[model samples]
Target: MDDTDQIVLSVDGLQVLIDVLTADGYRVIGPTVREKAIVYDDVASVADLPRGWTDEQDGGRYRLVRRDDSALFGFAVGASSWKQFLHRPVVKLWRARRSKNSWQVVPEVPPVERLAFIGVRACELEAIKLQDQVLLEGEHPDSHYQARRDNVFVVAVNCAVAGGTCFCVSMSTGPKAESGYDLALTEISDGEEGTVFVAEAGSGRGRSLLAKLPHRPASAADRQSAKAVSERTAASMGREMRSDDLHELLHRNLDHPHWDAVAQRCLTCGNCTMVCPTCFCTTVEDASDLTGKEASRTRRWDSCFTIDFSYLHGGSVRTSGGARYRQWLTHKLATWFDQFGTSGCVGCGRCITWCPVGIDITAEVEAIRDSEAD
Candidate 1:
């Protein structure tokens, strides 16, 4: 909130910000149009952004359409999150080889890359914070995650247009970014002056970067414009998750008939977990050469929806689709609070948009609550 942290950047000034980050040796990953979707990818300049494009999203549907004007950060949350960079899908844990008489082992070292993430939404920022808690501050901290997370910088974008599947307002995580970002940007256009970015520095590094960019001190009007945009986005959210006693509701409804109802429609495709920004389950695989002379262990992303994910000595624990679906919802909304002191869901609504059958979590939670009310 410092006066020095507030600034207004022209639409063209975005390229300067990217240049500064790149000059600082940070690999800038930002939103770009690819395969008809806005995805996070390597960005070099403003030209790489999805200009004049916004996305339409609903249950089990997503499409990019032309916007009324050229707004770089016009789209909502996409399938990919910053998690893909920090918590990699596949990582080699260690490699071992047979020695003359014994065995030699070599631990996998973490990669070295300085990453600067751009266009991170408020909900996505919360998801990253949750991952930090699980992978960095947990009892058994993951060194690989820590290494990648430590060197990364965040550039958060406040939502100006809420997608049809968005529910971050109800989750109290977004529409406007609060913290965890080095720099925060809010794009505002009155149609008369094209587009301008209202930027604020959240960290010392962010302040330094802002100093390097071609920016002017934000006016009182500029601040109000940004606030109005956030308010509009919050008011326009497509869904809402009632969190009052939500944990208890899920816990007591373990046997709720709604579980069976959703299970019948659920495909167990694991798309929800894959698209989720915060789901962090992983499994390890061990492989060796034909002669057994070399062996390597690699860790990869896994999903609770998978039957093999619950495999035990005899067979999978949660064999039924109903059981797996219940476990996922319960863990995500109920027990996760006990473990992480917060709900696992950020209400970004990726699971809803990406689900092939359009299974909506907010709707499911409401059905359970309504049933209890009955």
Candidate 2:
């Protein structure tokens, strides 16, 4: 919001800029050409990006296909989420080393990595904000998550093309970035002459990076084009959420019979929650050495779909699949606002597209709403 000034960089030039950031002691992470989807990974240059690559996705299906356009990052997210970087899949808390007669326990602190995450979507940015509340701002803070999050710089990218599964528009979390990013970029590939990116700085660090890049003064036309691109993405969303007041709708429909019907189709495979960028449930484990002299503790991601997630002193609270699924959906769309002051969903549609049975959250919500209407 400081100024409209921006530097235009060609696709190749953008890669060079990342190299420069790396040379200057910043670890650069961006979307790269993976086996089939555009995945976030370490990249040293532009060639590391998924150039001329796109994806075709449907319920429980996704495939990488070639595109005629020479556009990098023309696809949606891969299986990996920002959660892998911020909240690690697995972490060791302590290690047990043996002395002559007794064992000594050593605490393992998380290594803070100065990371620059490039090409983060607006929805993912919001997801990070949600996690920030849980991991950093919560009552009991996670020292490990705090270290990684504090040392990180975010480079957000506006979606140029909406995936078949994307519904960020209805969620109101994306199509364009609002905040929580150091830099935001709108990739312009539909121009008459060449490719260019319109960059905006969200912080002083971002402004400094822009100052070092080879860029030109942005014109009013560039700003207009960026706006148009975001508008198109909003219009092209594959799914739509009808409940403008999502919280009220979710609470009202809790007892709706539709929950039972959907539970039949749901495998409870936990794929939806696992791939979700904002789902932050976790469980801890303890291990001991063979001699029983040393013990270590580890933490890993957990899902509500799992029966043990709700387990407490007596027994599992959510015993049935329907109950657990309902808990997850209600918490994500309804109660999450009260808990985190934001909707748990980014509307990336990953849950719908990645579910083993292709269970569409939007369709389910509509069904419940329609039943109530009748």
Candidate 1 displacement at residue 311 in angstroms: 0.5
Q: Give the best candidate by lDDT.
A: 1
Which regions in candidate 2 have their CA more than 4 angstroms from the true location? 96-105, 190-193
lDDT of 1: 0.91
Provide TM-scores for the models.
Answer: 0.98, 0.94
What's the C-alpha lDDT at position 228 in model 1?
A: 93
Mind giving the per-residue lDDT tens digits that candidate 2 earns over 1-374? 85465656666667767877788777899988666677889988878878778777677888889988877767777767888998999989899877897778898989978888988999899889889888889788998898899888888889888888888888888879989898888888747747788888898988888787877777888888888989998888877786577899889888888888989998989999999999999999999878877889999998999988889998999988888889889889998888877788888888987898999888888888888789
Clashing residue pairs, backbone N/CA/C < 3 A, model 2? none
lDDT of 1 by residue, 94-207 (tens): 999999988899999998899999999999999999999999887899999999999988999999999999999888899899999999999996445678989999998888
- Write down the lDDT of every candidate, Cα atoms only: 0.91, 0.84
